[model samples]
Target chain A: MRTLKFLLRKEFRQIFRDKSILAMIFIMPTVQLIIMPLAANYEVKNIQLAVVDRDHSSYSQQLIAKIGASGYFRIVADPRSFRDALRLVEGNRADLVMEIPAGFERNLVREGAQNLALSVDAINGTKAGLGAAYLTRIIGDFNTDVRLEWVEPGRFNPMATIEVTSLNWFNPRAEYRFFMVPAILVLLLTLVGGFLSALNIVREKEIGTIEQINVSPIRKWQFILGKMIPFWVLGLIVFTIGLTIARVVYGIIPAGSLLTLYVFAAVYLVALLGFGLLISTFSDTQIQAMFVAFFFIMIFILMSGLFTSIDSMPVWARTIAYLTPVTHFIEVMRMIVLKGSGLADVSRQLLYEGLFAVVLNGWAILNYRKTT
Target chain B: MPLWAKTGKTMGAVTVTNLTKTYEKGSVTALDDVSFRVEAGELFGLIGPDGAGKSTLFRILTTLLTADRGTAGVDGFDVVKDYRKIRNTVGYMPGRFSLYQDLTVEENLNFFATLFGTTIRENYHLVKDIYEQIEPFKDRRAGKLSGGMKQKLALCCALIHKPTVLFLDEPTTGVDVVSRREFWTMLNRLKEQGITILVSTPYMDEAVLCERIALIQTGRILSIDTPDAIVRGYPDRLFAARTDDLPRALADLRANPSVRSTYAFGEYLHLAFRQNDTENVSGLSRYLAEKGHSGIEIKPVTPTIEDRFIDLMTRETTPS
Candidate 1:
């Protein structure tokens, strides 16, 4: 215990003395939190539309007005023919074009069916795919409106349809920031904690100070723990910085208890630091350790369900996502922060993180050798 | 002189028997069939060139490395099995400066003290003589200190634990001459306190400072004895020769069938003959003059440890 105390003291003194470490601890978290969420905005808005109404009927006008009123689209041009609307799309002024064929109201009344043509610019694939889907759904709703207005009780029998009124529970209107903020917090903590611990040990090795430590009477566990605790404390400081940015800059508040969030974060840091130290034990230089840490952290971030939902992935991909500790923490972070879940609600994920902490730390400590 | 006792008596502070180590699957032999011993309170030197495996032997004894094929012990503790005890009882300063560069001098000292489960306050007396010289620069980071101060700080850090044996590998390799002399003086002082010190160096002059030394080359121990004994074992009478043109004189001397060996030592060439006597020694002056060398001089000189070292090295290198 006395040995650990001195080691921690020495480690902390060096950490605070280093200019690069200080900059990484304070500046990196703030800049990443502010810039990443604003730039990573994925919600597509203000889609451009061109209209070609050949029939000039009130039905076509009403349809155009409804598309604009849905708040997803902006009608940029109204042309008399399909060729003119195609010009608008080709000129890049419109994202997609919608054309109503001639005699659309007469055909709809006589045959009860009509064809609506849609031409979308496919260069931006996501924008084009979503725009086409959105236009199709709006036209379907318009058709239902027309049938309700013109149907007579005795003239035609109408079949009942089911409707779903979706009540968004955690995030009303599903703001993207609430979902991204919690995960970003996890990413920043993992980066600061893992990198400092790994590079710190490898720096000692490269400078030949590790030989002195190896010959000393310090126990393996004491030395490893001494390395771990200082970086763990710095990681928490970075985490707090990210949270303040989320709360003040992004206005994201945790719906669950802060105590539970900290509990999960504390365990997650242990698992992550263990992983970093393991890489250091294998590597002899700081550059090698940094590269190894980057490979694993990149996998962790991608597989953590931070950018994409895990439920939509294939069986193999989902298995990989479940295996990483970050995935479990991200799930628990989203549950606790956005869903206002209590500790009891996320007990399964908590248990998994705890298991990861034990296994990774135990493996690293055993692999660290003082005699070789 | 051995102090005879500080706390307890032991057979040998360190003992190694037929130790062997190689790198890259026996392709590069670092230490081949080496063995030696250091009595308690004795200052022993491992003198050789840079790659003579002195550092490897020190590492093995310090428990930082394991020898592949022999038994070694430090302070009566086995280096392989009782390594923990050896680590606790021995102090090692590697050839390179290994103190934390970013840490202050005092902090590095305190850190190593606590690492061995002791405090600077408890063991301050052991390192007092060495540490006092460096105490004024306690606030300075170790990297910013001069080369000499760095070695002093390194020595203090190694001594803070107050172990039974101290291992210093090439501690004077890069130090200035005055600092090197001062360092050896400090070692003698530490020896007076009954600490067994094992020091290695490439400088032959430092060999006489230790009570005994083992001259090594190419991972082999050529000779191990007191410096006086090793010098007395010189086989043939040696002569120092110099002329206006020294290189030509060396070549001319080598051309003689009776000349056994000749090599430059500073401004003069030291020559050892197969059949050495006063008549041949005086006749060498006329021989150099006949070879067209001017201002020729020849005289018999007492052999130093280095003279014997070179003689042994040449004898082993040239095939019988």
Candidate 2:
């Protein structure tokens, strides 16, 4: 225990010596949490739409009114030609176009069928797809209303439609910021936890100080744990600052117990520190360590689904995502903050992260050498 | 009682036998079948060049590394089996400045002391003599200290544990001459306290200070003995010769059949004559004069440890 204390104190002293590191640990996460979520909403609104109304009929005007009333699209241009409608879309003035054929009212009355063409710029695929779907649903509702009015008065309607009332169980209204702030916290913890420990040990090796420790009475485990504990604490401190900012500034609080978050965070920190140690053991220079760490952190953060939904990913990618500690932690964090999930709800994720912590730390300790 | 104290021994000795270490799967032999022992309370020096495996041997004895095939003990404890005991009983100052550089000098000293399961106050006497030098700068970061002060801090840290044996690997290689002298003085004082010291250096001049020395080259021990004995054992009579035109004179002398070995030693060239060459001094001087050499002087000189080292190395490689 004394050995462990000594080691932990040494680590703490080294970390506190660098003031820039302190700022990075405490300040960077708050900025990311505040900025990223505000910019990342999935709901598409105020879409610029162009219309080619060749029919010039009452039915076409009514259909346009229905789309405008939905508040999802705005009729920015009324182009007389198809060419102008395409030009509006190509010039970036409009995102979607609607065209009503010349005989649209006559066809519906004489042949009981009519064609309405909708075109969308699919470059921003998600926004474009949502716009198209909203337009189609609005047009469908308008057509049903016209059919209902034309039917005999006071007749009973027999057709039924299934309605899905999406509750958005955890995050009602799907506030992107609430979902994103906790994930950013996890990312910040990983950045400080993994990169700092790796750079610290590799710096010692580069400066020839590792030789001094190897020859000391200190054991290998003592030295490694001593190096890891300070960074682990730093990780926690960053996580706490992030949580505080989320609560005070954004009115976001964990739905689950804060204690559960901390317990799992501790486990994830071990995994991160072990990963850093493993990198340090293989790298002989600080620059190499930084690059290697950057590579792994990039892969881990991207695959962890901090910015995207893992369920939307392909089957193979989802399988690979399960291997990342960050992925599991992000899920647990979101579950706690949004779902107010208890221990049972997050047990599977916690178990995986805990297992990662043990296996990685064991490997790191085993591979570490007391001598060069 | 502590295991070392329970033994009731006053000093520590190290024994290494058939010690071999191969790196990169037997392609590089850092140490090959090396064997030696340092007596209790004696100062033993291992002298070698950069890759001669002096550091490797020191590490093995310090229990930082295990030899591929050998049985070694420090202070009666097996290096492999009783590594923790050996670590507790030995003080090692590595070849580089390795203390926490961000910490103050005093903090580094205190930290290392605490690591050895003791305090600076308990072992203050062992390190007091050296720690006093850096005590004024106790609050200064170790990185901010000068090379000399850093060396003092390292010594203080190493001695704070009050170990029975002290191992220093090339401790004075980059230190200034004054600090080097001061470091040796500290080692001498520690030796007085009846501590066995094993120091390694590439500098041949330091060989004289050790009670016994091992001259190693290419991972092999060329000879191990007292400096004086090693010098005395030099078989050939050596002569230092210089002329008005020294370089041309050296060239002319090398061309002469009577000279066996020639190397530049500072301003003069140390030359060894063939054993069978019966030519008198005048004959060699006349030969130089005839070759347009002037103001030539030749005198017999005693061999230094470096001289003995060169001679031994030359003889070992030359076919009989």
Candidate chain B TM-scores, in order: 0.95, 0.92
Cα TM-score per model: 0.84, 0.85
| Tens-place lDDT digits, model 1, residues B1-320 | 12323333356898877889898889999999887778899999999998999999999998888888987888878899999988998989998998999999988988888888888989888888888899899999999999999999999889888888999999998899999999999999989989999999999999999999999998899999999999999998988989999889989999987789999998999988888566787677878888899988888899998899999899889966
In model 1, what lDDT does residue A48 have? 95
Q: Which stretches of candidate 1 lie over 4 Å from their true place?
A: A45-128, A131-165, B1-10, B239-264, B267-271, B274-302
- Candidate 2 yields a Cα-based lDDT of 0.86
lDDT of each: 0.89, 0.86
lDDT of 1 by residue, A219-325 (tens): 88888988999999998899888888999998888999999988888988998898888899899999999999999999989988999899999999999999899
TM-score of 2: 0.85
Say what the interface RMSD of candidate 1 is.
0.9
> For model 1, what is the alpha-carbon lDDT of residue A169?
82
